[model samples]
Target: MKRSNIRIIGVPEQQEEEQGLENLFEEIISENFPEVGKKKVTQAQRVPKKMNPQRPTPRHIILTMANVQDKERILKAARERWKVTYKGSPIRLSNDFSTETHLTRKQWMEIYKVMQSKGLNPRILYPARLSLKIEGEIRRFTDKKRLREFISTKPAMQERLKGLV
Candidate 1:
């Protein structure tokens, strides 16, 4: 159900209400994803602020796309583009994930960063899987223990990721 949903961050509070979220979404599409042209949004609303109410950053906008394909396209465009902005101000787009899924993904971030610094191409797959390219083959790891076990065989890789694993 949440697959087609995305969260928009950094848009100021009440900005969507002035012109409407649907219009803002359309503008964002047109601005950052000209190829996408126009797409439909099934639902659009601002979620409650996650941090202190006094903070300057506004509440996140939850956008349910008309279909999962549209969501994927938008995300792909966001990735290819250096940055996604609305009216010159910067904004961020990300998949709307459940708390568990988000936390699970966070667990792999340290290792991911380490691998990235080592010049290894690392990608985090959907639902908390880590992918790394060693030599010419790509390895996918769902958990840290399994990743550690596999890295143990590779002395160089094991050495590179000693304490992290």
Candidate 2:
């Protein structure tokens, strides 16, 4: 018995000829329809002009250093009231000596600075008056005679004692 092998050739050349024929057919169709050869068919479009709307500018209110001072005092009073009511202890002059108390002071100073920068007066609205109710409640638990004596002895606590009175 003899073994024989057959080799194949010219298949790739035939595939290339088929590809060329397809390209020629496409070119003929495009030539017949020129519109098909164009990048796009654009309609007569009208571009509208852009119009900017008018906006109203904001007006600022001016504040003085006296107003900031008043706000600082009010905030200090509020913080003192918070300390007395929540700390489960008697209201004393030394209560304002802690970092917790000083946080409120720092926040108040920040608010004051923001108000000053914005040229807005720190107005004591109805909300601030509502905060005073808590202050009054704390005052009921305090010893008025002792507070008065302490305030007289130390000028630092005078304003806070006055609020209690």
Candidate 3:
């Protein structure tokens, strides 16, 4: 269900209604990926988080693509291109993960980077599972405790990842 949706950040706020947002979405696609013209958007709206008076950036827009393939195509393009902008200002496109899943992934980022730097080949699987390549084999961990246990088994990893797990 979340696969078809994307969250767009850094777009300036405007008083325009939903139709305006749809047009902006189109503009975003055209600006970043001209070949991927006019993909169907089932829904487009700003996220419902309460506005903070001190924050300068606008709330992110959550876009739902009618077809998951289109979403995938755009995401692939964004990854390859490395810069997706709208109206000359930088914007970002990413999967619309639930709060819990997003937080879980966020928690793994420090370890992910350390593993990556050490050439562990870490990957964050969908909905928040961490996978690592260890000695030509793949190992997947569903939670930090499991990962901690696995790391504890390896003396080298235990020393390197001390206090992180």
Q: Of the candidates shown, which would achieve the greatest lDDT relative to the real structure?
A: 1
Assess each prediction's global lDDT (C-alpha) against the native: 0.89, 0.30, 0.87
Flag regions of model 2 displaced more than 4 Å.
1-96, 123-165
lDDT of 2 by residue, 33-116 (tens): 333342211111111324445732211111121233332443344354553221232221111123443453454444345434
Where is model 1 poorest over a 10-residue stretch in terms of lDDT? 48-57
**In terms of TM-score, which candidate is stronger, 2 or 3?**
3
Most accurate candidate by TM-score: 3
Give the worst 10-residue stretch by lDDT in candidate 3.
Answer: 12-21
lDDT digits (tens) for residues 41-63 of candidate 1: 99999986478867767889999
* Runs of candidate 3 exceeding 4 Å displacement: 15-19, 51-55, 106-127, 131-140, 155-165
RMSD of each: 3.9, 36.4, 4.1
TM-score of each: 0.67, 0.16, 0.70
After the best TM-score superposition of candidate 3, give how far the Cα of residue 51 lies from its true spot, in angstroms.
4.7
lDDT of 3 by residue, 53-139 (tens): 898688899999998899999999999999888878899999888788889999989999998887778999988999988878899
> What are the clashing pairs of model 3?
none
